[model samples]
Target: MPHSNTSQSKGLALPPPTIVLVHGAFADASSWSPVIELLLERGHRVLAPPVYNRSLAADAASVRSVVEQIDGPVLLAGHSYGGAVITVAGAADNVAGLVFVSGYALEEGESLAQLQGRFPGSSLADHLVYSPYPTSDGATGTDVSVEIDAFPSVFAAGLDSTRARVLAVSQRPLSADAFGETASLAAWRTTPGWGIVSAADHTINPDVQRFGYRRAGLRSVTELDAPHLVMQTHPEEVASVITGALAEIG
Candidate 1:
């Protein structure tokens, strides 16, 4: 059964908002494993869905579908590129709030390329490996992934070596087109938001995270001296942020 918590403002009981976790580029829903375990233990209903990493519009639509299926309010939390996905998806009527964990918070008419370009410190560009794949229309599409040997140091710096190695090899590549697609909506403009900045991040550049979160005017901003994979290294802290967002939503 779903967890229920009382809304002090209405003086009535309501089911706690479901947390929808969206994974970013070069990663799958499994990236949320540790955080999911913690949220579940606390009785929060959590769904960590996989984003296609194909394009912003398509990915957002996919997640919005998931949110609309839920019975009650939902708190959409996304990591990395997943952040961009939720930025557009969180506009769904059922979405109550957003939590950006080492994620992007883009504005309308902006693309991930545009946002990242504004801040120039990320080393991710240098480490990316691009390859061609066949698209549905029989045309070639480009997939972007980090070099296997460089993935651990760049994307999962704080994670255990053995686990990081496994993750490196199992990464989900993002379509190159996603970088250039502009976001049709900026949900944070209307939705309440909170953010966690991985201060020592190398994958997306900590400054990029800071700039986006600041512009979004998120309700709360927490900075941790962690790496790009803050979810893996600091699951407890990430869960706390989500819990806090839920409290505010109540």
Candidate 2:
């Protein structure tokens, strides 16, 4: 049977919400590929949208635009920096709930830098490579990415070395400005939420995930003994968390 919600007044079944998977910095929508495939096989409608990795506000706006266009309710699950993006974007009226997968769940007025700084254990800073990119205004802006050689260890730990290397070379870079920009709104503050903490994460400290999720008062929190790329290394576990959230939402 298809997943659905019950209408209290009409005795009708509302269609299951479309799941929107948002990838974090240093990755694209493809980062959700493993989990996406699993979700699809389980008869769920999913969309893994690209995050521009520009500025928090811009990225959140871009995601919000996508959510706004969906026909029914949306279940947003974000990984890494994408968690921050959805923290802002999930405020949409159609957004029914949120899932944070090895992600940073920021509070209102908190910047990614602020949140990560508090935990102080991520190896991501040491492995980051910054390069200058020209902005639309003809100004030079900094783009931050994981160093290719170090990406496999720092970001994709536990994945096949060859596959990790490919991800390293093809990684998307996030704007340096995104680190300092404060989230104007925290959707998790209002929306029902679920979270997953990659206990072995090196990109973002597991403590950071725990802290944010606790503050958000999420409905459920799962801790996985996985690395930063939990979606790839533990797709089934990640999918289970999402489907669990869906079941509860229904």
Candidate 3:
């Protein structure tokens, strides 16, 4: 392939921006494993930081820390509630773009709880199981989890029951407050963005996903028929979208 003058000027077609992936509630950084490999194969630097689902502010701070430590421009991607975290963290100086994979892109002062019902396709409320825990201030806090039996139907409908069962058993619960806490900034307002909206998503309504993308003025969107765990179920599709965002911003 012949190189463009732009590539020569940059010494090597400006390498793809580093990708920082943020996993959502009920899942850990491992959820991004498949996508991570795909991105790596394509010669992209990737990082997945573990987010403490205690509060939006705390989660955003964690993501921001990762973004800051990255040496160059960053492409920030988030799944599920992690979308909300990136919405705040993407405001960092290093972030070049945002990618929302089955994520909620809240406006300033909006929250996951508020966005969950905005389009009303979620069946999550019906499948939740709550347990009490101690908070930082020593007060009681409620942690919400999905019923193991209902996990396949509500969060990973496309996966086999056996696989979904394992995921459910290993799932991490999020603090009830994380969902209710309001976001202070909407990074999508200033950052270029891309979205992967899962058509069969029951965790975060598909229509709501569209609404979020539209609200964020995303550069483009790729829709998949997979469920909420689209990245796990269709890693190639999700990886392609991330690479697409890199190309768009580059």
Worst 10 residues of 2 by lDDT: 1-10
Q: Which whole-number lDDT from 0 to 100 does residue 116 have in model 1?
A: 92
Specify the poorest-scoring 10-residue window by lDDT in model 1: 1-10
How does residue 214 of candidate 2 score in lDDT? 96
For candidate 2, list the clashing residue pairs, or say none.
none
What lDDT tens digits, residue by residue, belong to model 3 across residues 167-243?
A: 89999999999888999999999999999999988898888889989988899989999899999899999999998
Q: What's the TM-score of every candidate structure? A: 0.94, 0.94, 0.92
TM-score of the candidate numbered 2? Answer: 0.94
For 27-145, candidate 1 gives per-residue lDDT tens digits of 89999999999999999999988788888899999999888777678999999999999999998887899999999999999999999999885878889999999998999999999
Question: Which ranges of candidate 1 are over 4 A from the true structure?
Answer: 1-14
Which stretches of candidate 3 lie above 4 Å from their native place? 1-16
Error of 1 at 44 (Å): 0.6
Q: Using alpha carbons, what is the TM-score of model 3?
A: 0.92
Clashing pairs in 3: none
Better of 1 and 3 by TM-score: 1
Give lDDT per model, in order.
0.91, 0.91, 0.88
- Backbone N/Cα/C clashes per model: 0, 0, 0
